[model samples]
Target: MSLSVVICCYTAARRVQLIRGVQSALEQAGDRDEILVVVDHNDALLADLRDSLPHQITLITNEFQRGLSGARNTGVARSRGDVVVFVDDDAVLATGALDGARAAFEDPTVVAIGGAVRAEWAVGSGPSWFPEEFGWVIGCDYRGLPACGERIRNPIGAAMAARRQALVEIEGFSTELGRVGDLLAGCEETLMGVQLQSRFPGQRIIRHTDFRVDHHVPADRATLRYFTRRCYQEGRSKAVLTRISGRQAALSSERSYTTSVLPSGAWRARRNPRRLLALVIGFGYTTAGYVTGLLLSTRSAAAA
Candidate 1:
């Protein structure tokens, strides 16, 4: 099966992190259908990459729009492969990850695969106040995920691979949904997965936890303010997602996460006083964000 790996970058600030991503791709590279570096409306970054990237790797300027979704869509357009894998510019893949993707796509029913991501803390350890249950804040596959390869609702953008045909059929990632420049908003991945499922019922969007990557979480993200803001932004993003993809099913997992997961995590943290407080604050902030976002969304709908 032919494979195309796409990496998206938006700034020169991430140049060091981007180098690590490039090296990982090089190590995993073979006869790729193509390896594209999609620069998202950043001419300066694009120019710098022109002097930096190896000649074998294809460079793409995202003319589609100015977000991660658009950059990814541009990459998909330039790619000629049965399967397209999107990797984050800040992540490094595990050995044989690409090979595993090629093998997984051999099954025609497997439309997409989300590999696990292990957090690599910039300070070399997780912050005490940063609850592991909220790991999704950094785009890492947080806890409560399935322990093995199985049908998953969505693929985390850090390392998600999908069939070329499925992405085309669904019209690729939504420009309204994902990260644009500095925004932490997501749910574009969720929207794409929902579309894929709608079009090809019973098709598998598998989560293979063993196909892993090291995702760097900067120390700045360890702050309570950052975590809370990210959670708030996620709530807003999900509101938009629910609007675009229907409410009940789009929020099924959110209900589970709120009603079940956080409560269990709070119980587990009972022994640790700080952790207990962290869990409570985390849940409170996130729920508040979701409600506020929902209200704003309702107002927007009424106006429309």
Candidate 2:
């Protein structure tokens, strides 16, 4: 299957990372593959990239809403490949990543595929207090994901792909649920996976460990404050997803993560006071956010 990589960017602050991401995609693209750089309503960044990027790369401004989901939707619409892969602007595709995705899609039963996202910290390694189980807060592959090739409820947004038809059937990513400007809200991918499964019953969404990407984790995201805020936002996103897609479908993976994965992680971190404390604090914040979001959503429904 021909691949179309959609790298979305919204700011000039990540100009360096975005360029590297595009370059990585370009290097790994097959003869039939294409790379599209979607700038989320940023005119200045669009103009700058147009001049700096290679001619083969297609750079365009987001013609939909002003956020990550909209930018991704715009890319999906413009792309011509059989598989539309979404790569974050701050992430670099590993060698053969596109090939891996195409190979997996050879199975007609698969509709979506996601790969590992290794963290490339801005400082030495990463914060010692950061727990591995909560790596999703930084868009990295966390501890407790299935061994690979196993089915997943959803693919992480930073490095995921969907069959073009599957995406078109679902009408692309929902604009309601993703990062808008500075808001950390997300779960667009989660909703997409649910929609895909509903639309094509029996189809699979699996993770391919070989199809990997290295995501740049800036210093700002390494802080405790950012960690808490991100965890809370994740909870809020999950609540929104549950409201839209029903709780059973929305929180299936989360239930397992909470009951099985987290307990194991906590036990492993018991020897490290800092990691153990971080895990506990992160869980508390996420739970608080989920409750707050659920209450707000319920109130809004009644008010409506």
Task: Estimate, for each residue in 252-287, the C-alpha lDDT of model 2 and write its tens digit.
Answer: 999989999999999999999999999999999998
RMSD for each of the candidates: 1.3, 0.9
Once model 1 is optimally superposed onto the true structure by TM-score, how far is the C-alpha of residue 75 displaced, in angstroms? Answer: 0.8
**Which pairs clash (backbone N, Cα, C closer than 3 Å) in model 2?**
none
TM-score attained by model 1: 0.96
The candidate maximizing TM-score is: 2
**Model 1 residue 207 distance off true place after TM-score fit, in angstroms:** 0.6
**Candidate maximizing lDDT:** 2
What candidate 1 gets wrong by more than 4 Å, as runs, is none
Clashes of 2: 0
Write model 1 residue lDDT over 14-99, tens digit each, in one string: 78888898888888877746789999998899999999999988998997989999999999999998889898999998898888
